[model samples]
Target chain A: MSQVSQATVQRVTADLYVEVQQFYARQMPLLEARKLEEFLETLTEDGSIEHRPGGWKLEGRQQLLTEMRARRGDPEQPLVEEISAREARERNVSYYDGLVYRYWFDRMHIEPVDEDTLRVRYQAIVSMTDAAGKVSFEPTTVVDDVLVRIDGELYTRSRIVTHDSPAWADKIHNPS
Target chain B: MSQVSQATVQRVTADLYVEVQQFYARQMPLLEARKLEEFLETLTEDGSIEHRPGGWKLEGRQQLLTEMRARRGDPEQPLVEEISAREARERNVSYYDGLVYRYWFDRMHIEPVDEDTLRVRYQAIVSMTDAAGKVSFEPTTVVDDVLVRIDGELYTRSRIVTHDSPAWADKIHNPS
Candidate 1:
């Protein structure tokens, strides 16, 4: 294994920082547009996901699409995009070029299963705007475990996570 | 559309937690063991990785392998895993079943690009350990734009983010 010089590490780390910022600026809006096919294009062809319990665990683009079919029973309520924040860290770097990283979603925390995988988790307090643009708040949490691979390509094999359940009354009484 | 009950969210989130934890237990060992082929099984067949400048994108499993081959040139330095600390928050909930979440990883963070997608921007401080257990620190940051389709499936479409330049030393040392 090539010893990572202090200079090499700094350069790699800085490059990674800038890469993350660009993703948001260039790709987020398109996702929020619910351009399903377009959004999927952002990932590798074999990309997959697995959350947990009964309704988590999707694999491959085809399977992913099948899962999406189940979630978007109504196209109108398609998953929309909202920008909150993004972060990453190389928790540990071992001798053999292994890098463990963690990623955060609003209230979700994702760690790696290996050098090339992901695991997600979260706990959160949230605020939402209703159709009238009225604001509301709630507290919730989630934990997601995902596996990501970057052999020469980037793709996820597993994505398992947990989330809090919502009540019908909450949605009915306080509709977004 | 099915109204999401608070209970549903909580239950789902919890399951996600357990799944993620399990994944870590299973995956970390495999990686530290350097079971590269086994690790490959955990990724989508057509996965891709966006590593650095000059459009260093790797697509397909074989491509990923090539990339890894180029990096893991050292047999002496084996990979290792470490524990991670993280936090999460729900920023917004849309009437359209959209959720905006913010998750923090050490000093970095990732937020939802939309209900199902994520945007990440981050920098990190890594301590590198050699075969003799010598320790050194390296700072590497990554900005990732990832989108997850949460239809019983979780897959990332794209993760486009900037990273510190490989030639950062020249820039830093020379002050260009």
Candidate 2:
């Protein structure tokens, strides 16, 4: 096995950090607006996205486009993005409430695989609003966006959304 | 067994959320400031923190504290927190990224757990920034915080932070 030196790790880390930051800025808007074509532009045509459930990995741009269209069948909703911490012990765990609101956007999550390729996971919360039309503090809905990166860029490979959480489930306005 | 009503679930969720929020607000400052005595008060006396290394789980709060203290001992290389998320996907299985930012006295991530007991998996790119004279990001020091709810209250029972993803590591760190 080759030894990963401190200098080498440090260099890779810096580049990876830059890549992640750039990815975040690009993906935030399209997710909020539910713009499929615009979102697809971020990916390599031959790239793929994988859904966490059913272990279903969608390959190629065509299947990804199909999934995006299906997602658009439902009306888009508002979501806020933030960062929070969790303390895990043994195996069971719980997350602390309150989060450092980084930059709230219509965005999702992504992970890297190897050097150029990446795995992506996107989510949105579900919540209810009051009669005053103010957004409720509670979460109502959640959407998942997972993708793969090809040639140092990300493309939508797989996606899904669920109503189990109140932020999205109860308030979902199905376009069908 | 009786079905858990949505109202019941909502109430539980809200209460749990509040408790976690309070715990963080109270403890974050002490932990970040490295106020050991004050920080220790937040734990349940016998409380412990864990990190993943190879095929085993590290145990004990004292051990964790000792490790943290030693890491902090590096004066030339001060340790700080920096968590950033990239993407996420959720369904029966959830995936996530780009939902965390940590800075010594402050930390945040979108934590998702199962509805039954509220055991959540931490899926975020957690970066630590080392601040000596000025604040800078630490690329090599990354971590994940796992959590669980107990007795109708939420608390971080465990943490599984490792250099690589866990065995069940999927997508994580989306706000769902």
Candidate 3:
């Protein structure tokens, strides 16, 4: 990691910085909105994510899609009222209410690995706001991402996430 | 507002969108770091902010600087141990610990008010992360900003912020 940091730390151009930021801006919201298919499109066909704390990896778009689909459930199927009520009770919210998660990425440092690929490291803070408007944070994580330029558009090639704390180590579920 | 939205809703070019996002991306970190002088540089000399909930306005760079100075105090003067201890007690943190605020701006909608100026509206969510890593959110806000291009660089000419909820109406202190 140190060698990569020292040897390939190319200065990110102003244009490229903005382009990368915009890419995440568009991509993360799709995940938050549960637009799984759209979110998957932001990654390469062989894109992968490694959860360091969980010691698990999801490789390729098909595997990624399968995991995400299982996590998000079938969007076409409406939640049963009984299950909704049980979830509400478990979450301490009204029957129809749920948590809203907002992901904020900051302190981004970008380094060029090659002409087509860049290494991007950033702090990912996930804030869960409940029906009562209270916000709580998941443990902060530092994500190292490999982004590739494909025909002038940016896509994630791979991601490695390391949590800053182990409090939620057992709860690692999200791909990003 | 509707008239402006309807009449001037020009499609934001990819270049312009990236430019606008980049402008805020650079401008906001200055504020979080309490780099008031540098943050002020991102605004026009005659830039103004109107707090809709508070019904108070700070007009021009001088006034904005004065308010920020009061809020941040003199960085040159070190805080006495007694005062630091008191603040720690008040914030329920260790003697040297403090809260870190992260500002996230999202869901931006940009419209060309004219050739030289654009009206940008976005949701601003401020999260306060404590030393213990607990995060709480301030009431969300919708900020409408008028940005003008000066010598090909973007500068904020004016900002109007409307709180989404009244929870923090009386606690509004920061300029952004």
**CA RMSD of each candidate after superposition:** 22.9, 22.4, 9.5
In model 3, the number of clashes is: 0
On DockQ, the leading prediction is 3
TM-score of chain A of each: 0.45, 0.44, 0.77
Task: Mark the regions of model 3 whose C-alpha exceeds 4 Å error after superposition.
Answer: A1-123, A127-135, A139-146, A150-176, B1-7, B73-97, B166-176
What fraction of the true Cα-Cα contacts (under 8 Å, chains A to B) does candidate 1 also have?
Answer: 0.00
What TM-score would you give candidate 3 relative to the actual structure?
0.56
lDDT of 3 by residue, B81-111 (tens): 3333224334443221244456767788998
Of the true interface contacts, what fraction does each candidate have? 0.00, 0.00, 0.03
User: Mind giving the per-residue lDDT tens digits that candidate 1 earns over B31-141?
Assistant: 334454564444456655674543457676687675554333333533322211110001211111111111222222344445655444443222334545444332233
Listed per prediction, chain B TM-scores read 0.48, 0.45, 0.77
TM-score (chain B) for candidate 2 is 0.45
Pairs clashing in candidate 3? Answer: none
lDDT of 2 by residue, B26-102 (tens): 76556555565566555544456544433335355675565445432332332222212221111211111111224
Name the lDDT of candidate 3. Answer: 0.66
Error of model 3, residue B118, in angstroms: 1.1
Alpha-carbon DockQ of candidate 1? 0.02
